[model samples]
Target chain A: MKLEDATPIIQLGEHLLVSMQGDLDDRAVLQLESDITRSVSETQATGVLLELSGLTIIDSFIARVIARLAGMIRLLGAEVVVVGIQPAVAITLLELGIGMQHLRTALNAADGMALLHEIRE
Target chain B: MVLAIESPESVCSIDSEASLVTVRARVRATAVDLGFGIVDQTKLVTAASELARNVLRYAQRGRMIIEELDNGDRRGVRVTFEDSGPGIADVELALRDGYTTGDSLGIGLPGAKRLVDELTIDSRPGQGTTVVITAWDS
Candidate 1:
């Protein structure tokens, strides 16, 4: 799959927002990871918000990848906040025992950005 | 080449990460076509994904079947995954949460079981493994 197939990352000032829409294959996830990591340096963004409200499924692979992505972004000096996880996805993650403790989460994009601002300040 | 079954449903081969993607998409679409809601669709699709990934990671290649199920007034989607790799040595231990033989999160088996209405696993050490999952409309 092309890089375009993955959701685009929107830049709002110093923070970047990536909202996932439908089910993403492993390729798309890897593409997004490389794209976002590159954007972190190219745009010099201080925070990144991953919006997962549109995704209903959070398989073990995807969850593991997201966790690794968060770590990569942090190494690039940007805080990552995952937002808008559905109830089902949340339950699935909990049952899977993948709390993603290293990453922060928000109820929605607005709150996620707010939390980002708090972390930055 | 992608193989097509003569029946109403179809089976896809999972040999690479790319094929796993195809299986996931096909299962999700099949669940939706069977009139499953978003939540149920997600569950089945997720379950399929985990199992398919296992096949690629462990067995090198496998086959997945996606078919519609009808039981009088109830309708559901059923998916079967078969792999001819080193079978599980401990089925009971593998079914329990937090028991992973590989370097994974240990959620593929137990997590999949919770997501669907029915799950059956048959395996013989050094032979192969097969998993069947069924989710009914609520």
Candidate 2:
């Protein structure tokens, strides 16, 4: 399925902002990874911000996919930041040890963008 | 509003990845209807997802039963995943974090335990494995 039909992944300027809402199964997560990686190279985006404010759950499967996607995007030369992780999700992830240490995180999308800028500068 | 007082909701014949996703959605919806907060619902659903995935990855077929748990004033959701796959040779090692038999990350069992109040695993090498997890309302 196309990324647009599944989730809102918008290309703004040189950055790709993805807003993940609702339930995301394994297929959706894989699709996001492929779509984001392609978008990074095609748009030459300097950064990608993933917003999870609306996502109620982030299991190990989803967490691993996010980590993988960040690494993939970085190889394509774009900084990736995840924002709006809920307190419950954070607590669960830490408890589960799916720390996702490789990816950058921020309190919100705007902060994530600012962090990307900071890294570029 | 709690209906499982009569009979627990059951999802049978989970033999593929797609079935695992269906189980997660079913568990999430039941948690919501039982008045579980979003955080608790996410925790239960996430735990269910992890266990369900284990059933698919290892056994290739399994069944799940979701029930409303009540102990006096306490209330919770209990999910039991049963599979006839080759049981773990070392349950302790399997329960340990960062231990995995397959290529995927070893976050299924331990991570699932942390997400719930009670987690129990019953398995034998030649028999099957049954994992039951319960998350109480705080």
Q: For each candidate, give its TM-score against the true structure.
A: 0.88, 0.91
DockQ of candidate 1 is 0.53
Q: Is the docking of candidate 1 incorrect, acceptable, medium or high quality?
A: medium
**What TM-score does structure 1 among the candidates reach?**
0.88
For model 2 the local lDDT of residue B2 reads: 41
Residues B14-59 of candidate 2: C-alpha lDDT, one tens digit per residue: 7876776678778888788778887787788888889988988999
Worst 10-residue stretch by lDDT in candidate 2 chain A?
Answer: A1-10
Clash pairs detected, candidate 2: none
TM-score of chain A of each: 0.94, 0.92
> How good is the docking of model 2, as DockQ?
0.66
Query: Could you give candidate 1's per-residue lDDT for residues A14-57 as a string of tens digits?
Result: 99999987767788888888999999999999999999987768
